[model samples]
Target chain A: MEPVSEVSGRAIPFGRKNIDTDIIIPAHWLKTISREGLGRGAFQALREDPANIFDQEEFKGAPILIAGDNFGCGSSREHAAWALLDMGIKAVIAPSFSDIFSGNAFKNGILTVVLPQEQVDRLLEVARTDPINIDLTTQTVTTPFQDRFAFEIDPFRKHCLLNGLDEVGLTLSRDEAIAGYETMQAAQMPWFAKGTGLAA
Target chain B: MASRPRTLYEKIWDAHVVEDRDDGTSILYIDRHLVHEVTSPQAFEALRLSGRKVRRPELTLAVPDHNLPTTPRLDSAGHRLPIADPESAQQLAALERNAPEFGIRYISATDAQQGIVHVVGPEQAFSLPGATIVCGDSHTACHGGIGALAFGIGTSEVEHVLATQTLLLKQSKTMEIVVDGDLTPGVTPKDLILHIIGVIGTAGGTGHVIEYRGKVFEEMSIEGRLTVCNMSIEGGARAGLIAPDEKTFAYLKGRPYAPKGSDWDEALAWWKTLHSDKGATFDKSVRINAADIQPTVTWGTSPEDVVPIGGVVPAPESFSDPSKQDAARASLDYMGLEPGQKLAEVEVQNIFIGSCTNSRIEDLRAAAAVLKGRKKANNVKWAIVVPGSGLVKRQAEEEGLDKIFIEAGLEWREPGCSACLGMNPDKVPAGERCVSTSNRNFVGRQGPGSRTHLVSPAMAAAAAVTGHLTDVRELME
Candidate 1:
């Protein structure tokens, strides 16, 4: 996973609500063994409409996606995140996100910014012409037109995203605590280890 | 000032918090993790790239479900493996190769023990009260029926749990939905939850953990409760759970992985405390009357887009929001329905009675009861009955449920998540309509341009026999 900090780029002003995984990356695209080259299949059904925003000339290579309330509302497929990443999107600005989708995006270094509906609407308007800038350290998303929006992210997540601390890194950092718990478990409930494949 | 009492959601969450980071997030430990072929390959690949071993391999279970065919390919010796589609073939093969390499147990496609991750978890007693279970597939919340705090996680989170045996989570708000009074005899748990989803819009439970409460849930059978909780994700809840009660303990007792002897007593004592403290409050609560719920079915793309089985298709113009109205209009176009069309009058060409939603043995029995001596309507060109698990298949066969299904012209097949997402060969032909027991009603979820009317297994069975959406309650026993 890549560490994310400050991002500056054009934003795709696709402010649609409750856009599910089926819309993001259709199930047919999930058959591939590799996560590579999913951008072609991203929004396959919607992109069929020649007028869709994702297929427009200006939105190509955009790094931020400005979406409406409750985006990413279904499925636990990480392929949705992979598809967005493949499409060159680095951040998603929305009013809210489905928990599973946001978790997936966070792990894959795609920053998800939650703002109020009004603020997201304002950003959606701002995204049409100028670039948007996001600074994780400052917790602010700024537009070229002097529009500024402040957001809140869990401090732990912000730190992890900033430092690229994946789960393995996070756990290895706390090896002492995990080892301590396992040793205690060995004493208190030896049978717990019996059925388990853990070293007895 | 005294502190407010904690809810079951809180109690379980608090007990599992290994370390609070003081930043609105905590490292929550997971006791059990289930995985399937569709989502784990990338996670396993990530572990390989990072040179990591699964921290607690024994705590994890893997199975091939989403990409496995439901038709058994028999060798001359009668040995069977479920494989037909080549892409799905690769998915199952990769999972088989990855499990042993990572020290995790892989229940193969041919293994009679193999099933959907959610079904196999509780069947083998791997999901216990107060346990925190995570899986790469959604509907992991089905385990919540057994009183475990279970829910779906993305493959990246799956890799996180694999490498660390814990997740860093910003806790969710809690919702308590209390449904009191007895359910009318024909009102199944599927109807009740579909009713609940109708009450709460598809996004209503967003950012909350729903704790199902009141007499209705307490009296519900574990299978019924599983059917309800399995679709919790449909209403946007990360997880939905009921407090473990006598029913839960009774279901888990004597199962393969359940506690034994004095351990059983000790575990029961602990599980008894899994419910909320008296007078504990939730962040949000919705009260519902059980008697008011009817046999429910979906008419639109969203799970919340449901009405009474006898109700008419909603007119998009009635919706105040133009976007939702447009969505409804698009859905009607896709479903081949006109505004105010009677739901039961719509013809259905196919019916699929399976999925994590309502593929358990109880679900089979409910549908079989309706299909026992009835012949499927000739208009219902083809129908299929897929059990939730390999074990469920055996038990259903023992009860002659397969014979009844076959006699009704419904194909009784091997166990896998067939046609739920069309990862396998069981797909509805384009432009055709199907009454499905799956949790989703997303456009093209069954196959491209396929119209899905989500209903209970009994309702699906009814549609199979009637060739249209019909109320299972109104069908003669």
Candidate 2:
């Protein structure tokens, strides 16, 4: 994971709600077993439509995506987050995200920006003309036309993403606490200390 | 100050509250954690990296399903397809490697009990009433059929549960969806849920925990309840639950995770009380007549764009909203179906009766009964049934259900999430239409440009026999 301080990129706005993980990366893509080349398959069906946002020239190489409410709603395919990352999408602005998808995005260094629907609509409009700017430190999304909106994130998730930390990182950060708990548990439940026996 | 009376949700929630934070969320102690090969790899890796042992090995279980091959075949190394999906294989291997390392019980691919985590969990009684079960799969809500508060978690959360046996969460508002009265004949639980999705639309239950109540749900078998709860995610719910009753206790009594001997009596007594009080209030309530439900099949890319069997596909002009009209037109065009055409007249190239949604033994039996002596349509390229678990497969085979399917020209294969999505080789070709027993009918869900009509197993079987989307009730007549 890497901290995304500030990012400037093209905007690909998908104006649909409940864009599930199955649509992002179809289950067929799961057969290969490797995360490599997933971006090519990302939005495969969407790309089939010549008028799709992903196929539009303006959105090509877009490192940021603006989506509608309840984005990434289906299967917990971490590949959805991975594919978005591989497609060079560093930030996603949406009204809300599925909890599992949001967690996957945060862990993979993808910044999921939660904005009000009005702000998202405004950003989608601004994205038509100029590159969008997302500042993690300021907690705001700014456009060249001088429009800006602040977004909210879970404080703990914000901390982790800002520090490029994952769950493993969070757990490691509490090494002393875990070690202390282990020692205390060993004393309180002696069976746990016996390495090879059942606890109860 | 007035003390608030606790609802069932509140009681179970309070019992599991291990820690409360300033942010107004609680860390809930998970009573049981079920894992599958697909999502457990990364969690195991995280545990290994941290050098932490599983807190309660006895409380955890694992199985492999999503990527297992429906047909038993040898890979280049002579290993099975369970070891085929390199990623899934790696995950399965990691689970096998880590389970013993962590002293957790894991059912490998070859194990007769190994299958979809949801299917295996209930069969093994790991998903008991009044328990807070967490799995790394969205359909973990399937366990909620027995009055358990089960929900899906991410890999990190999976590791959290494995290491600490607790989940950090904010409380969700409860929504009661009551379907009262007797379901009309031929209106199965699958149809009832599909109709619910149609009425409420996909995003209606967003951010809510839904509890299905009333006569219809109460009378449903444990399997039927599971089918309904399994699709909770499809309706945008965090999870779906039904209160525990005699049926629930009967289902768990002799299973692996149920309490033994004297403990069983105490467990049943506790489980019986795991229900809402008479005056329990909910944030929202919606009631629907069970008799109004009919055999439902999706007509468009989304599950909400569905109509009852024999109903006509809606035209764009039928929609008042311009945006909705455009979506409707596009979906109809994409599906290669004409607006106003009868749904039963639509041809189906394939018929799939599997996936977590409708792959249980009861589902198979329903389809088998319909296809018993009938031959499949000549134009139907494929009709397949993939059971949810090894146990289901074995049960079906023991009853010669496989022979019935094969005799009817339907393929009987091993248990896995086959054809539900275009995950494996069982996908319908691009531009083909299918009648599926799975949950979703999203664009290209079965394959690229493949239109899917979601239905019950019996409906799918009837469609396969007719080469079109026909009502299964008609076949019975």
| Winning model by TM-score | 1
* First chain TM-score, candidate 2: 0.86
List, residue by residue over B16-50, the lDDT tens digit for candidate 2.
Answer: 66556666666666777887766677677767777
**TM-score of chain B, candidates 1 onward in order:** 0.98, 0.95
Best prediction by lDDT:
1
Tell how far residue B357 is off in model 1, in angstroms: 1.0
Best by DockQ: 1
Candidate 2: the clashing residue pairs are: none
The lDDT per prediction is 0.86, 0.80
lDDT of 1 at A51: 98
Specify the poorest-scoring 10-residue window by lDDT in model 2 chain A: A191-200
Candidate 2: regions farther than 4 A off: A4-7, A31-37, A49-52, A55-61, A136-138, A163-200, B1-3, B73-94
